[model samples]
Target: GLKSSHFITPTPIQALAIPPSLARRDVLGSASTGSGKTLAFLVPMLERLYLLKWGPLDGLGAVVISPTRELAVQTFNQLRDVGKYHNFSAGLVIGGKPLKEERDRLSRMNILIATPGRLLQHLDSTVGFESAGVKVLILDEADRLLDLGFLPALRAIVSHFSPGGPNAQNDRQTLLFSATQSQDLAALAKLSLHEPLYINCNKPGEEGVVPAGLEQYYAVVGLEKKLDVLWGFVKSHLKMKGVVFVTSGKQVRFIFETFRRLHPGLPVLHLHGKQKQATRLTIFQRFSSSKSALLICTDVAARGLDFPSVDWVVQLDCPEDVDTYIHRVGRTARYQSQGKALLFLCPSEEEGMLQRWKDKGLEVKKIKIKQSKVGSLHQQMQNFAFKEPEIKYLGQRAFISYMRSVHLQKDKTIFKLSELPAEEFAASMGLPGAPQIKLFETSKANKSRGGVKQPEVEVDVASEEDEDHENVAAQSKVSGPSLKSVRTKYDRMFERKNQSILTPHYNSLIRHSSSASESEEEVFTLTRRDHDLPEFGGSTSGKSRKPLISSEDLSKRKLKAGGSKKGLLKIRSGPDKVIFDESGHPTTFYEAGKEAEDIARDSKLREKYLDEEKERMRKAHEIDREVARDKKRERKRKRKEKEKEVSKGFFFLSYLPPPPQPPPSPLFIQKWAFQFKVFP
Candidate 1:
């Protein structure tokens, strides 16, 4: 099979690591990616199983743990290929697949390949799990696993094969492999390996260097112009197959949309952590087979998946560190193939990291392209007709999954629908209808502001009754008694008395009232009045009453003088004097003569309405709680019933006579007699 597959010569890692691994010795291998490390461990794993004559009934012979689902799938494929001649059975366990389906196939598998998290889930949940018969354990991409915060999961998985664990056995061989060996990997080896043989196949000056066949260059541009530069490059290389690495899933969607719009006929795909496992695998297969293809993705695709004959690797942004940069570029120049890598750098942003790349023995050159050309490309892209991106329109189920993924990525328990840039993001992905987003409020502080406290108000926007009630309350404020009517009533109340009324100071009183009805209303009217009278400016006698100034002039003069001594002259309209107390919170009077009374009334009405609204909300919340509780109970009851059915189906088997016990050895019988004073 090796010869048939063209494995004529061993790679450096293969030659050094294979012999010991085949000998059943634990091996800790460190070699740069694309060094054929997969075969280095895979060949030996198959050879050992073949030598042991392991078969289906022998239980699981080996368990391989990968950091990512893609890698796990890739490794499983390779294992299948190597074990095909031996007729060995293998199975895969990862997320995004039906759990029951995977559980049903466990009994027939001789080798299992899985991601750490998913494998741990099965270890705890799967009944009759064939873990105790495992003979080998392999952790691929050990450093990447640790980098992704999977150390705790990895430890839990390792414990499954330790003493007293489900997979406990004496002949377990552990193999650990990675491109880089960090202190964390060293510590992990202490816990996972037993006096392992250390294999380092890295070249002397190739510690942080990309493959020699990969030609590396970078283009410097402004932050705003990166998309334009990227478009120009992709446009120029439409026929070339390549991968574009971005910093985030959002960027993956953005770049894919931009390019898809510019060249609607071209084959373009995107993969991100948030995508469904099945969708990701489909996209991966499609990209691998397409002759002229583009894959826009995040770091999820950076390490350890074999992509064939890639011509270019474009890093849309500077990678976080050197290892990431190497792995990304390594995706292209695999198996000594010639490839090009272009690093797009924003002006002055990551220049330090670029310098560090040079210092770390990587050969990188800056590729200069005319800014005018980029500008021209940008203009051309603008002129192109906008085509909707080729993203699938999400149904309700997919939309819920999408939202749940976004929330999980943010590590948020509650997410506000209004806060999500849903329309823009959805349109970029060419989703047809706007998502019906629901707002969830959480008790935690705002994470974006470094845990700053924020006030939260929960309202059910879905309730039409609540909305109508709010609308009615607002309308009543507008339609209630006009300020002019209140002023007229005040004038009527005081007009019966003949005593001359003075210029009133309306700023010295607080009036509180409700707008519900006249009977429920309470108003406190305060006015400062003067007893001395001044005539309107013609006759001095009381009957004519025209002595000082016009009514309009007197009013303006009184406003400008504002309770001053000069404005003390009384202007008689109606004849009742109202006095105000001097010691109270001062209120300003506007042109609306009854403004104070109106405001006081509105405040009381609002308070009453708010109380009623609170009661309604409380009732609605209680109903929602009850519904959720009922659903939970229904689900629990169904699960219990299913368990009972399964137990009943196996009741006859349980009642069958237990397998005959084997006769005890003399030593075991003597020990048992000593402990219990009885022996058979």
Candidate 2:
């Protein structure tokens, strides 16, 4: 397997550590990252298992525990490559996979590479899964495993193994390896390293160091300028493949989203603890194979993972400690490859972090950012954030996460939250305003590191130089009333920004930083934009702008805007009375408000008169209707009488028809007589 993988001369750590382990002696190896520590321990491990002739029925022959799933998966892949010829059945057991699938095949795995939490969980719960017969144990990143944070889980895992055979010797051959080796590892861990051979290839007393081929540098930038500098750097190095290490998952997500939208001429990806397991693995694989891409991530990707052909490693935020910085840079310049690193430091942290690096024998070149090289993104960012509520929301979350991460830092000397320019940072992210954050933090790390002597009080952040809104003033003079009592973390959490959490340490100190004010909401800005600085910077256009209209038109526009009167009187007469006369016009009732009030005062009398008038009208209407009916009857009678007379005339004419004919013949003679009678 080694020859097929192009194995040549052995590395120094591997050369020394593998031989002792081959002789059945426990080994503790320490070396710089990517100095072939993985293969060093891995070679001995596979050889030991092969020599023992371990089989699938050995009840978990080897257990390798890594701090992260990425590292565990990596070690497993390498194990397969090294042991492909052997008949050892191995399986990876990590979180984010179906428990049933893992349990169904778990008992068959002769070798298991897993994270501590998952391993401990299986030991405590998985049926028929036993590690008592385990023969070998390997801890990758042993320093991380031995830290106080992970010590409890490690102890439980160690307890699952059979007790050391004799004189604290274990049933298994343990191999412990880490880049940062220290005596504190032994102090923190109990009996994990027996009378084992301690191999250290690094310089003694140094925790960690940069690779020989890695060029390290730092830029002392204010928190407000960090984003712009990072943008400028990424813009300048568009074709370079690298990782941007931030403090929190939210920060990673925000940067990834924002930069992706900006289209920085490279593929942008993000990985954090919050992503799904499948998503993380997919992203990890993509980044590893990608030629030119930028990965924004939290510390989840900082340790024990390797990417090929990476050109740069940018630490946008200061690392928690020197060890982290070493490992972060170790991701690049692997196997003697050349790489570059850049760190951003605020002025407050510059002194302390420089001293720390000097103590560790680490060297970094200090460089000033050139204004010509940097692209200011604050205006564009603010515009986008203002338009997209989603971006604004993400900006807020990222802001809070950043503040929380800074507050949670164990090294208070370097990670001073008060020194950060939160409002400026928000503006750089395209946020209209800085999201509010309160740093009332208390943790075991704080106590251990002496970070916050007491839980820090949170008040409206104003300019540190502004005495009017000082934290002391806020506490001393609360809005409503003063309460002389201590509040718990829960109480503090429910406490709104309006309420200030005061402490008994009323030393009346005016602590200030060169950057932003203490809290986010109380940021005190010292300068205004060129457009806003009329008195200071003059007009933004260099020459004053005059209105583009005639004076008369301008006056008309101004008059239209407000306070203009109509030429015609808008004298609104009182609303017409509800009652109307038969002529379809308004009644004569008074509509004046005072007259209506007087009428309302006499409403009882008016109502009585109205009722009497209504009754009288009803009686008069009945009488008129009866008179109309009588007239109608008289007309009908006249019509019937006329019809009867006409009918009688017609009957008389029919009976006297022959006599009329005779009378007509004599009419001519009687005509003269008729004429005389008519004249008479």
Candidate 3:
């Protein structure tokens, strides 16, 4: 056996929560990553199973549900060590695995740990509680499950177990565990538990940002400087497993490519929702096992994942919201281990997020550094000058002709700093505190005075024309597009028609009634034979050729014809009637079948409830065999006394009184009998 000293000490969260959980009380443990929450629940669960003598032969009893497959596997492996002493059979049920294998294993397992979706799939199959006999249920990441919209499935699974009571058969214990208890999660808990005990460890100043183990760092730089600085930071952390969080999938690909090119030997891989589950799992396994220098990913891999050895987390871009920011920083500072976080801020999006972080009382280490000049290969390609060797890159006149063909207009709005060299341009123009240079603003009403006194209106108009031409040339230089694509002054007069009919007014204007007109009655003429015609000419056997053109028929036919055209021709037609229900969705003919099924099921449920009520009332008055056979002792005693009295009288009569005549008076006999009875 490994010594007790081999195990790491408990964190504050573990210290506070493990005891209550071991006593079979509910717990809501809220702490950031690397806070020892995994072991907090694991230790208590293992200890209870150990002391209670729960093993595989007892049938499947304990179930742990996690949000992701990877987290479930990690938790399974963590507890497997302690479970070894008692031969506890723990099975894993997650997606991307065969259902038959999970079902077969669940038939004779002790603890079945699974993700919600896969577990629900098994429940949808033929497997029942009689086989598994599940007793103890644990939701490892309960908040995540609710957030992922698994409440309906969770409720159905919980309903399978009998309600806990003294006479209840197959009563099971439920344990809900989560790092964060959102409102939706709390609502879900109410459905699963029976007045459960609530435990919270997320106290302010103690459970939040002020941790002693992890160090937080921040740097302010331009948007272009982030990747270069992040690459530098990753190169510094040589042996640690670090993760870089970018914003988008495109950014993920870009950063991954850049890192590979910059450092070939670095074991860096990117994981996102766009990748297949198999590919994601493979990358995660490789990254977790190896001493990968960095793992580049997005917010998709942020929550419900465990990486115990992650030493650092670098936020590539400031997240848009506080929750996203929290999830990004949460990757590190996990468990009882130490971690470091580095946040890179761009000039375009720094101030707002920085203030928000500061308001949250985080001692964010802000470092103001000069922006890095190393550009991405993409950016370099965008900025490089191309010189052709053919015909000595073309003579100057030939180049001018080519430029004219391309309509390469010159930027006439000369910047004050444009005269400076490339080296000075970045420092002089790029600095935030640079003084304001001359900026030209066209004055619609200004007139330049003559050299001495007269107002030069013609000169003013000439300067204004020059400015307009300069503005057009500057725009043309920035975007190298064909001149034909540019809008002419004459094109501005007409309003831009909303080419698509997908607007509220599209159906309203079908009759073209916007123009003023007197009331007029609409008329239609219909033929009986045309009424039998099929739509879209699907099938028509011996249909009459005499077409009747009623106004209604004309309108319907035109609408059908319009609907056949694809894309932009589609109309945003409103329903004849609007129906609003509890759920905020438009109820149209499309959902009629589903609504009918729902109504039928509700009626069936009501009938079931009524039957159950009748059954309960009947059972309350039921009498058993033991109660009906019980006799009264007093009745038996009285009967025995009467028989004894009669026997005594008979004995007395047989003794000697038969030969005696009526010799005594009635009063004397009565008195004598009374005396005799009293004496006896």
Candidate 4:
């Protein structure tokens, strides 16, 4: 199978990791992406099972865990291709499939390729799904598995198949592999590996951890110009297949939608977390199979998935760390193939992120963007946004998402919001002005990491298929933590201070919108205090903390002349508030009895007041009309008097015209005498 599929030689990671893995020794491997890491462990898993004379009756021999569904799918496909000569029943156990169906067949799967949440579900709930004889425990992208997010599920899953279990897979040989391996030995310790060997392909004083054939370059562009540089690069490399990574899904949609409308001479596709599993799979297949295409997506596509013949990797903003940087660039330059990566760093992000890359022993060359090559998209973006309101809305969302992502960054030195040219960035996105990010500035967006397709209210801009997917996304739920609370973007958008939109216009946009499951949204208040606040100084001992600026002290604080940026922007109506009650706080309809009566009384009084004002205005308008008529008559009379005076002067000049013929006497007499003589 390997020879038929053109897998000729073993990469460094495969050579090192395979040997230790086959020797029944635990192995923790770190290798650059696209270095045949998938095959490294699969070979050993197949060999071990073959050596043991394993069969279907053995009951779940091997379990491969990946951080993402795309990666899990990729691993399952690779396993099928290479392990075809051997008899092993492998099944992909990820979300988006019918849980009951998966459970029915899951008990029969000898080897399972799964994500953490779904696998844990089966381990805890599925009947007859035994892991007693599970021999090999492999975690692909182990760094992500060790992240704070996936840690809980990983711990729970590991607890199910530990060595002390009654039918444990004989000391459970474990293999952990990632492009960037986790450094925390304590976390790895929880996985119960017996004296794991760390196999890293990186050599001291060698060309960095990234693929040697990959050429890396970066440019110090201001926040506003990053998009321009990216657009220029894309336009220049229209024939080259590439992936452009942005910070968030909103940004991915904005770039893809707007750029596709602009017609960049290539097929453009977008992949983000909010998309449905089917839509994501379809897009993944499309991009993978295309002869030449460009993919604009968030970090969702950064890990283990492979793309053939990829030529370029463009990163719009600095990634959170070196690991992400490696994964993003690793998409290209596979197995000695040459590729290029371009990084766009803002003026504020350049120093910190550059030094970070350098500390990781990476030598990224600095390059200047040729002003001649950079195509100006400001006017084009502005025109589209100004005319097409859909484009305008998307631009606003993209800007907001970028700001919030930067604000939420753990490192302030690399992502300082104050130093960024936000207004310029807004303009570059084609917005007339920047939206007020007061909500993000003071309070974190507190976006829910789980549940609800989160298609994130990233309105499907153009495609009907994408629109359908987005509608399903609003109701679809995932298990980052649980299905109990899904943080959808519905509430965050309502709270955003979009100064560009009029009250009625904006209301109409969201008036008909619906959500199947309403996620918990951020709330603002003057009295309630949170421990995460900086003023509290990180004390969590149940000690009573003081509110720095309360309603009473608000008048005392010398606030700036304009509106204050300190207070909460959106607040849920409290019990004490008179204007509203908690029976579904006011939308287009008022549910509270008191509020309804109050509105009715106010309406009557307002109608009477309007009638009186109308009467007064009518009387005043009549007087003004009469004054204007008198002014017009007086001007007509003045014009008549001036014309009469001019006519009288003209008549006098005509009456005196006969006295003006005395100048030609001599010439006239001589001419008359000559005429008489000549006639005789």
> Model-by-model lDDT, in order?
0.70, 0.77, 0.58, 0.77
Clash statistics: count for each candidate: 6, 6, 6, 1
Task: Put the candidates in TM-score order, highest first.
Answer: 2, 4, 1, 3
Show model 4 residue runs off by greater than 4 Å.
164-169, 205-208, 438-680
Candidate 1 whole-model C-alpha lDDT, 0 to 1? 0.70
Residues 1-680, candidate 1: write the lDDT tens digits: 67666688998889999998888888999887688999988898888888888877888888998888899998887776666687788888888988899989887888889998889988889998858667788989888898787877877887777432124455788889988777888879988888789888777766645666888888876544666677767777778998998777766765565566566356989999999988999998999889998899988999898899999999976676678888899898887778999997655544566666765677688888776556333433333313422334222233444444444333222222334544443443334444554333322444332345443322223333455434533543554332132223244334433323533533222233444344334334444444344543234566766335444445755656645543444332333444343675444444234654565589887687789999999999999999999999999999898777656645544454544468557786466444442321
- Candidate 4 or 3, higher lDDT: 4
- lDDT tens string, model 4, 123-143? 899888888778899888877
In the range 370-466, model 3's lDDT, one tens digit per residue, is: 4343333333212221222321222222222222222211222211122223222222212222222222232222212111232211111122245
> What are the per-residue Cα lDDT tens digits for candidate 2 across 1-680?
88777778898888999888777667777788788888887787788789888877776888888888889988888888877888989989989998888999999988899998888888999999988887778888977765525677887798889864335443577888889876767853346656778888888667576678999999998888887888899989988999999988888887887788888898999999999999999999999999999999988888889888989999998888888899899989987789999999888889989999989999899999999878787887777687888778888998888888787777888888777777777777877677766554343544443244444344434333234335343663453123444444454333334324555332233334533344533565454323322222223355683333343434555535332334112222234456665777764566555556776689787797789999999999999999999999999999898777666655554554344344666566356434434222
C-alpha displacement of 95 in model 1, angstroms?
1.6
Candidate 3's C-alpha runs over 4 A off are: 1-5, 50-58, 128-132, 164-171, 203-210, 222-225, 235-240, 248-250, 262-265, 274-278, 320-324, 346-351, 372-376, 379-680
lDDT of 2 at 503: 50
Candidate 4 to truth, TM: 0.64
